[model samples]
Target: MRTPAQNAHLALLLEVAGTPKPGNVDRHRDLEDLRFEHFLAGAVGAQRGLEQAANGGAVGPAFERSVEGMAAQGGGNTQFGALLLLVPLVRAAADDLSQPVVEAICEDTTVADAAGFYRAFDHVDVFVGEPPAEMEPLDVRRGSDAVPALEERGLTLLDIMEQSVPGDDVAREWVRGFERSFVAAERLAEADGPLTERAAAVFLSLLAERPDTLVATRSGEAVAQEVTERAAELVERNALETDRKIVERFADELVERGVNPGTTADITAAGLFIALERGAITV
Candidate 1:
């Protein structure tokens, strides 16, 4: 069996190598300073922390450590979203990929995990929305300063996620039994091609399914909705690839428009991780 770190690292590579991921960087695409190499290095750099998570380490600190590894390697937070999904999945797979095992890990999250998550933000830039109105001064964007409030309420990471599910795609995955990740894995299985192409297709499918919360948080709901509609149109007419130029043009437009469907990419990475862990794909 491959180590959890290896699986996660490979999963990130596969997710990044998959080309034409709408609004996101891939092998054939670049985003200013965030190139494909940064992501590749970030994944490999994060392996040790992922191994710790698999070995029953705290998810939050492990996540923090992983993001720190990325920064240490000159990678600017390229794989934070991927790490967030993979750490728990890797930890759960240490027992089995069964839903109960994974759900238990999520439910067992502590305030420290929440703090670790916030600390990760201090190391990298991820556009996030405001904190819950009831939880003043607990903004994730506040970085470590919000930790005291997080601790004062003694809210577990899962508790924090539950509150954000309405607007956070990743949080929805955690609170809802990872429905999207697993479904994307199934979609990956049904699509036959190089593992990279399958991963890319799964990403497009996810973009068709919902507006990316990250995009909505960064841009606005209107832009995200427009992206969703475009993806849906491509998927509905089976024209995502029939006319390669059009698809490429759309990707170029999204990049120019600064609309990143990041949540979809994150979930796509999660799906790739699950597929590997389940032996549906080999490293």
Candidate 2:
């Protein structure tokens, strides 16, 4: 059996290799600076940290190491959002993959976890919404400079995520007990076809269900909602040829418009990780 950390590694590889994820990086899709190879290296490099998290390690240090590895390869935030979810989920899988256990692990996060979270920011160019003009010292863009403020206030990572939940989906997952991720994992488990195709379906299903927060941040809620509606329509299409045409066309249009449904992609990765851990999908 694959270890939980190894499952994380396989899930990342499967996620990136799942082609035509519609504006997200997949085997067939490559952004200007980020490619499938970078993502592959990132996933492989991150396994050590993810495994450590499964082995009853500290959350902050796990993030620190995983982000460092991802930065060394991708040199940007290729999987930062997914890393946030994977750390907690992998930890939970070690004992039992349930809400209460996961909640406890998240609830037990410390100020050091918050500090490590900020430190991970030091290495990546994560695309995000702009911070307020007058920043809190804890503003993530401040990087390590925010650590001192975290210490002064004794704010745990969970506390910081609670503050950010409204504006950030990843933070919302942490604070909301990963409801969306769990939902997506359920969808994934019931999906048909090859694992990659199942993953692609899950990715689009999630995009259709909600306006991707990353897309909303980049292009406003109106654009995000419109994209989501189009995805939903495509999902309901009866003919495979029509669906393919729609997805292909939308993929081109989204990239052209700089609309990446990255939050959906991250959620899909979390679902895949869960499926892998549960043996619902095998290597």
Give the Å shift of residue 85 in candidate 1: 0.9
1-283 per-residue lDDT for model 2 (tens digits): 8888888888888888876688877878788877888899888878888978999889988987888887778436788899989999999999988778888999999999999989988978777777666446778887888899889999999998898767688888999888888888888889877888878888888888888888888889899889999888888783223557768778877876778888888889999988878877665
lDDT of 1 by residue, 75-136 (tens): 46687777888888888888888667888889999999999988888987777776668766
Quote the positional error of residue 75 for candidate 2 in Å: 4.9
The parts of candidate 2 lying over 4 Å away from their true place are 132-135, 238-242
| lDDT on C-alpha atoms for all candidate structures | 0.84, 0.84
Worst 10 residues of 2 by lDDT: 237-246
**Global lDDT of model 1:** 0.84
Candidate 2's displacement at residue 26, Å, is: 0.8
What is the number of backbone collisions in each predicted candidate, taken in the order shown?
Answer: 0, 0
